[model samples]
Target: MAEPQDRAQEREELEEIVRSIGRPDAFVLHEVIRRTGNEELRRHGGALFLSAFAAGLSIALSLIVPGVLKRYLPAADWAEVLVRMGYAVGFLVVVLGRQQLFTENTITPVLPLLHDRTLKAAWRLARLWAIVLAGNILATAAIAAVIAHSGAFPPEIQRAFAEISHQTIAFGFWATVVKAVFAGWIIALMVWILPATGAAATFVILLMTWLVALLGLAHVVAGSVEAFYLVLTGEASLHDYLWRFFLPTLLGNVFGGVALVAALNFGQVAPEVEEKKDADGTG
Candidate 1:
């Protein structure tokens, strides 16, 4: 049996946590921004840049795995599903490896900033976003160039890369942007849920990524692989990719991850927290 005071304190603490989770407004967004800003600052630019690069490089494995599966199961219609599962490989590696991924940053750091609404916090998030996006794009391009030129994969796999490139081109600008927004929303949610999952984080990461692939959603870093491959092969122009795919997807992702998911998450919790604070002050 618990003491009366102890039980009361426990109930209060639980209520506070629950209230925090329920709010989805500016205050909560500010909190998320501040917390993420602190985390980014603590990690520093070097680690963040390197981790983002690693995430890009590792995520390229998703492209490769699907190609390998395609080669092995060339005739099977369902093989695409199995091959697509390989898309989760890089996500698992990055998340479990504790690397900084840009999508995750979109929500994580913003929470704190939203809560505080300070100029410094806003600048921090802006800086982090710029660095992470640049690093991720560069890394993805480098890996894609290497894969295209290395001859490490068989001709069929190379052909598969071309096929993936063509498919991306077919999506056009708006579709890609819309798909990327959805993907970013899902990825942000994944990050939000991860801290609570303990050892099951990897499984959750896999499930989320697999869903992204299944839904034909676009991811900036991951999509860069296909875009670069096309550019390298002379099949698709860099101008087209940059204008049609990269820029739109980038904007959409930021909007989806930050505005739709993170902001809303903050909104939901803010009211409950305010109510609890009022109750405490009155008591």
Candidate 2:
């Protein structure tokens, strides 16, 4: 039998365990934002481009899996569910691999830019964005070209790709833009939440990206692969890809990532940051 003192200690320990399950403090999350922003600003153009290119290639798996699944599975609602779940794979790889995904840029570097608000910082942000977006598109286009003519993918899988691309384009220009905004917003939020999640970081990535897919939200990089697949297969024109999907989605993602997530989050933490600055100066 435990003594009363031992029972009280056990109760206290249980309370601490429960408390430990809560979210990270604002300061810790702010540090994560600052560190990630600084790191993105610091990466060289060549390295950033290579990582973005790899991310673009990896994101193709999201499209490819849906095709493969549609080829193998019986037609049903569950098939759609499984297909949507597949969308999470590429994001998991990119986020975990620490690749320079463009949508991710909408938030990460922006934080530091917000913190500094310098002309040089803005230029650096723009330069990084241009390099990463160009690399991602170039890589995805190359992959789409190879996939279109490689004779590696089966006829059924190719058919599935066409069907998927058609559905993607069917959403129309403005709709794609709106959906892409949500996609960007969610992805940026994932970056913000990850440091606080600790060991469950991967699960958060999977869930957030899965929500992006399941909701039919367009993601600029992954959607570029879809658009390029259509172009390479001769189903879509370059003009269509550029005007209909790419430009709108890109702008929407930038708006969502920068405005919806980073700016709002900065507003919430600005006071805390100012307080710390004053404290440091006084100390």
Candidate 3:
């Protein structure tokens, strides 16, 4: 009993020491981005594009994963639950790799921009959007073509891919865009929450993303999987994809992630920082 109390006291002292080191200031996030914006933009711009493209390619597995599981366990109703775990694999790869993903940028970098609000900031955001979207599409097209030609994935999986392709066509333009907006918001929230979660960030990100996928939220990169499937099958033209899915989803994602989450996050923290500076000045 005495040993247990001593151990508890020691643990409390260690925790207090850790706390005395202090949590990161909210402004630190903004400052890091502000200080490193140029180098970060240059390095991450290409990286984001490549990562977004990779994400597009990887996300296609989501559609096929369930089908593959079903093919093996056709009679098992609970198998659907197991396949959902596969959806997190791509997100884990992209995020942990520290690659630039458009969905994440919608919130992360924008917080600093919103706090500062400069012309250069606007230009950076524009450049990032253009590069990421173009890269993602190119990646999706390349991957889809490879999958269609490779004969690697089973035929049933290919057929299921085709089925998902047809469903995107049915959603028309506006609805797909609208759904993508919601997905962007959720993804941005995941990014916002990640910095605070520390070691558990992976699990938090996976849970949030899985929830987004399970809820039928549309993501620009993820949706590219289905869009490319149609393109590969020669059932849908790239023109339709550009006009219907790509443009609308792109705009919607930017609006949802940047305008909503990033802006709001900055709004919440900026005033407090300003007040503290004012107090310091007065003192």
Candidate 4:
């Protein structure tokens, strides 16, 4: 038999567990921002580069899986939906695997800059951006080379891959820029929603990335693999890849992720930060 005090404590614990059931505890805004910012600051050059390379390699799955699906699925009209679902595969690997994705940096690094507003912070941000972008592109180019020459899949699947790669850069330069902006916006929004998602984070990532694919928006990192594939196969010129897709989409992603999402969110929370500072000073 339990003592009365032990019984009361057990009853309280049971009630607390019942109340907590079916309710996931989401991360608060400031804690999420701080944690991400701190992690970025603490990550060393090698770690950052390798993680980015891994992400680039992994994100290629987005293109590869969809191509495989396109080759096998019957020529039904609705098969496109299944194809789009494949787009989430790489994102799942990148996000859940805790790799460094450049687009994700748009939000995470910006928070630290907002908090500090110093030239050193800006320089750190710039250095991180350059390294991650270079690593991602290098990893992606390697995948493109393999896909073009390694005889990794059936010729029909390779052809489908090439065809899908061409579609990624089919839009005109300005059109791709606009589309990439939307892509950046969606990606940044996904980053914002992630901290609050808890166990449902995978669902959020899949849904957002699928929407990105379904809407035909441009994503710089994932799109890099496709563009490189076209280049490797002689289907697209290096000049066009550089001028049309890579540069334009890169700029658009920066604008969308930084200017639109990070800046606005920071602005919304700026007042609360100031109030807290004032309170601390008085106390």
Candidate 5:
């Protein structure tokens, strides 16, 4: 009896780490997410915009939660670690809600293109990307403006927001791009892992997104909330928003998600896909 209870407690404490090793069947998972990407491409423009906008608005929790925590938590070695958990809250909402997040699009939609390799498929992927990216940016910009101008929070929380913005821009362009690459890689990896572990999706999202905040990596949508806040408050320039934050992070994210994760995973499964097609007389 004691042994079972002890194991249960251990699981509660270390649930995120239990399934760290061992991967799912890559080909099977690819097909599953590929179908998801296909469905996203077929969504009407209005529905896609609304979903992406919701995702942008939803991710605001990631920024706001950390800032609020920073304002209240006692400054200690472990305080920031605990505060970073807020990053997962926004991701949890975005992922689990099935909202159309742009970074997620970088990997999922590309799988369909890689498999189809047709002009029509490529065009659809590009269209989906453009709509989602535009919606995400517009929503984050709107929310940041409200946060900066609305004065809903106390001055202490506002200052915390400013500090977070300062940290986000402390890195130079190349440095931020590199960090964003890692951020993109992780986000795409999380998307890939989710279809495989339906039961552990929440833990995976929390662990991966929290890792982004803990490591101080640049994420295009989430980081833009801080950039917009800084710009709105006159602490940063519009040039800073474009040059210092947006451009590099976007490039890095696309490269990391499409080039590194999606392409490689597709490459691994391509031979098997072709083999199966030949076996079925569909090649």
Candidate 6:
């Protein structure tokens, strides 16, 4: 009886300790993200491009899954809500699969650049961004061509694809840009939060992506898949894709990731980091 009571009390104390463990603070999150950025900066160009291409190809699932959902679901009002959940599929694949995404690069690489600020660091960041963005765009273009030309899906599902693209691109240039900013901001915020989320990472990713889809936010790579599909299908012109969807979204995403996430976060932790470095005689 005495031994059993002691075990119970010990178990209760262990549970209390687990419950009382606190989440990492801003300084720790900043360090985690900064270290992640530094590692990415160190990767070779070919590896970065290959990973980014895989990410672009993987991200098409976000668009494709929604099209599938739209085709079979009822035409009821709540159906759209259910369909939006599919938007999270590709994000889950790319993020958790650890593929390189261009928008993610927008935040990850920027952290190193913000911290280092050397000409060499700036050059590395530029190279990383360019390679990743190009790989993502080219891969998305290829998949869009395949979807448009291949008879993989019946005409009905193809129509569903068209509908999704149309809705994504219908927001004019500025509106799409504004929405893209929110999308970028949310994605960057996800990156920042991920270092802290342990078992709930998948839920966090799904929730962030679903919010973007449900709110009609424009994501550069995912939206590119949609916009490129329209162009390849001859539903929209190359000019429309370049002008309305591509340019504005790229601009907004870069700004949102760099200015909003990288800048603000670095700013907040800068003083503390500098003070610590100075105290350690490393500054």
For TM-score, the strongest prediction is 6
What is the C-alpha local distance difference test score of candidate 4? 0.84
Summarize candidate 3's per-residue lDDT along 193-262 as a digit string, tens digits. 5654667878997898887666666777766767777877888898878887878888888888877777
lDDT of each prediction vs. the true structure?
A: 0.78, 0.84, 0.68, 0.84, 0.88, 0.87
List, residue by residue over 1-283, the lDDT tens digit for candidate 4. 4655665675565445434444323224643654566567657899999999999999999999999999999877699899889989999999999898999888888877876688998998998998899999999999888888898888999988887788777988889999999999999999887766767889999999999999988899999999999999899999878988999899899999998888888887777766765887831
Q: Higher lDDT: candidate 4 or 5?
A: 5
Backbone N/Cα/C clashes per model: 35, 0, 0, 0, 0, 0
Off by over 4 Å in 2: 1-22, 279-283
- How do the residues 1-283 of candidate 6 rate in per-residue lDDT, one tens digit apiece? 8966765675565445434435977877777677677668777899999999999999999889999999999997799988989999999999999899988887877877777678998999999999999999999999998888988988999999999998767878899889889999999999888867878899999999999999989888999999999999999998898888999899898888888998998899999888877898867
User: Which residues of candidate 4, in runs, are more than 4 Å off?
Assistant: 1-27, 278-283
Q: Of models 5 and 6, which has the larger TM-score?
A: 6
lDDT per residue for candidate 5 within 1-283, as digits (tens), equals: 9966765665454334324423558887777677678768877999999999999899989889989999999998799898888878998999999999999998999998998788999999999999999999999999999999897998999998898878777888999899999999999999988866767789999999999899999899988888999999999999999999999999999988999999999999999888877898867
Worst 10 residues of 3 by lDDT: 31-40
C-alpha positional error of residue 166 in candidate 4 after TM-score superposition, expressed in Å:
1.0
lDDT of 2 by residue, 61-94 (tens): 8888888888888899988898888888888888
Per-residue error for 19 in candidate 2, Å, reads: 17
Q: Model 1 over residues 22-134: C-alpha lDDT tens digits?
A: 44444443444444446564457887889888888888887888777777786775887787788899888887887767887888888767655779878888888888887
Colliding pairs, model 3: none
Compared with the true structure, model 2 gives a TM-score of: 0.89
How do the candidates rank by TM-score, highest first?
Answer: 6, 5, 2, 4, 1, 3
Window of ten residues with lowest summed lDDT in model 4:
18-27
C-alpha root-mean-square deviation, each candidate: 7.2, 9.5, 9.2, 8.1, 9.5, 9.0
Reference-based TM-score, model 4: 0.88
- Taking all chains together, the TM-score of candidate 5 against the true structure is 0.90
Can you give the lDDT of residue 166 in candidate 5?
Answer: 80
lDDT of 1: 0.78
